[model samples]
Target: MNGILLLGGHSDIGGDLLTRLCAGRPVVLAARRAWTLTEVAERATAAGATEVHTLDFEATDLASHRALVDRAADLTGGLGTAIVAFGILGEQRRAETDEAHAVEIATVDYTAQVSMLTILADTMTRGEIIAFSSIAGWRARRANYVYGSTKAGLDAFCQGLADRLHGTPLRLITARPGFVIGSMTEGMDPAPMSVTPAEVADAVATEITDGKGSTTLWIPRRLRLLAWIMAAVPRPIWRKMPR
Candidate 1:
């Protein structure tokens, strides 16, 4: 049976997307804390997944990523999709002052993502690798520069990688959503054009199911124009805007 794998299965968006993608398919939910996914696995099964399995996945552990990919392929007949949904929205203030915190943010958000995506690209014979980027990457704000910078790097990498996969069976979809109001941003004020986890999942599922296979996805569509406007803003003015 073919399957869908969620690399960051514990996140709200990941959980939402998993339910949407798992219909009539086996699913592998891989996360740093796999044991806590009993409820998620149940939800996937209830949503029509043929079967569900949770695997221990450490984002920073590059050495074991390939093995994890191999196991997923082995468990199911093949992977229909692999969602790279793991990332850290590190505290900007703390990251600015602490070197360790900065490195943790960069490593998890960008480095780990690239490593897993590279492995998935090389190993998967047929599937799509969906990654979550943010509109924040379009232009780094002084308030959250550390997180934004990592997403910027990831977005650029995924774009170039998509170009390189021109004739390949595998594809990459980089989703750039505006501020997502969710558990991740519990106490923070919502930004304009904020989207819910289900909304993001629905848009992505439609893109995949309808064969859009577009290299990039702009949630709510208007984010595309907003991204351009943000990119064109002068640095002096950009730095002054409160994010």
Candidate 2:
């Protein structure tokens, strides 16, 4: 039996996705601290996963991504589904002065995602690649352009990749979640159309499994209209608009 590969099982969205998905199928959870995530596996098992495997995967460690993909394929006969739910959000002030911190987030958010997807996409003959991007990518937000820029790059990358993989049995699902209630966004004000882990997971499940052919999934569905309105606004006005 094949397995579903989740690069960041430790994530709230990732865990929710795994719980709702992979029923009766083995799941492979990859993370930096593999041992610390035994409960992740247990929960997946309880959620009807056939089995669960753990792996060491550091998002920023680009060199190890090849090895990670190799290991994932070895565990499962073929990569049926790949969910990249790995990311980080740090203090905006700290990231401003710390050049290394800024670059680290950017690399992890964009560079490493490309590397991992390339490796995973190559090995995945037929499956869906669901990437957890953010609506922040749509435009540069004054509050968090550092992170926004990274997500912007990712969103564009996914679009091009989706076009490239056209008619090849390889599906790419770029998920641009608005404000998600998760560990990362703790203490922050949830955006207007905030969603939950389960909701995002459900949207992805419906889009991919049901053969919707929708490469981009804007959470809450209405976000499609919202994004259009946002895009039509003048840049000068957009810059001044409060987030």
Candidate 3:
């Protein structure tokens, strides 16, 4: 089997997913600061990875994305799986007044994801590409619309990309998880039906191992019902919903 590449080396969910998928394979972890990948690399090694490597990555550096993928492919021989796991949950309140902050969220969470996914789809002849969407995207709330809007756009992109890859050897597993309670949401109150990084990883990893074709998964599965309910919520009330 070809090796695996994780775009966000330091991401909690990405690290967990790598531990699940890295057995006997060469693994590449790419992050903004390669040094921060040490713990994740060690875990991958303990999990039976034949080799573990790290590369410097910058999600906002669009010009460098293709080069990073090429470098990863060079390290792994050819990538059989790539997890697009880099994103930011920018400060919603600050973003309301700071255009730069809002754009930063847009660039990292949506534009960068699109750039990377397109490159991976075009370059890799087969295997899987994993992308993250969220319940925040299912219906935008006033509290976090800036962040939510990006996820909304990303979810739509993934839907189209999954269809484009239909009947192909390459498959996209778009994971739509709800309220992940992790380092990202350190001080925030946990939302109803909140899940952890491990849970998200497990759901996606199981699908990667056992599923066929490109599929969009509502992590926890029941989130689909919540998503339906979310859609039917009137805008006035939906705008009042908490993040």
Between prediction 1 and prediction 2, the one with superior TM-score is 1
Give the per-residue lDDT of model 2 (tens digit) for 10-47. 89998888888888887889998899998889889899
Q: Write the per-residue lDDT of candidate 3 for residues 37-131, one digit (tens) a residue.
A: 88999999999999998999999999999998998899889999999999999999999999999999999999999999999999999999999
When sorted by lDDT, best at the front, the candidate numbers are 3, 1, 2
Residue 12 local lDDT, model 1? 90
- As for candidate 3, its clashing pairs are none
Best-performing candidate as measured by lDDT: 3
* Residue 231 displacement in candidate 3 (angstroms): 0.9
- After aligning candidate 1 to the native by TM-score, how far in Å is the CA of 112 from where it should be? 0.4
Q: Tell me the whole-model lDDT of each prediction, alpha carbons only.
A: 0.89, 0.85, 0.91
Q: Each model's TM-score, in the order given?
A: 0.97, 0.95, 0.98
| Stretches > 4 Å off in candidate 3 | 212-214
TM-score preference between candidates 1 and 3, better one = 3
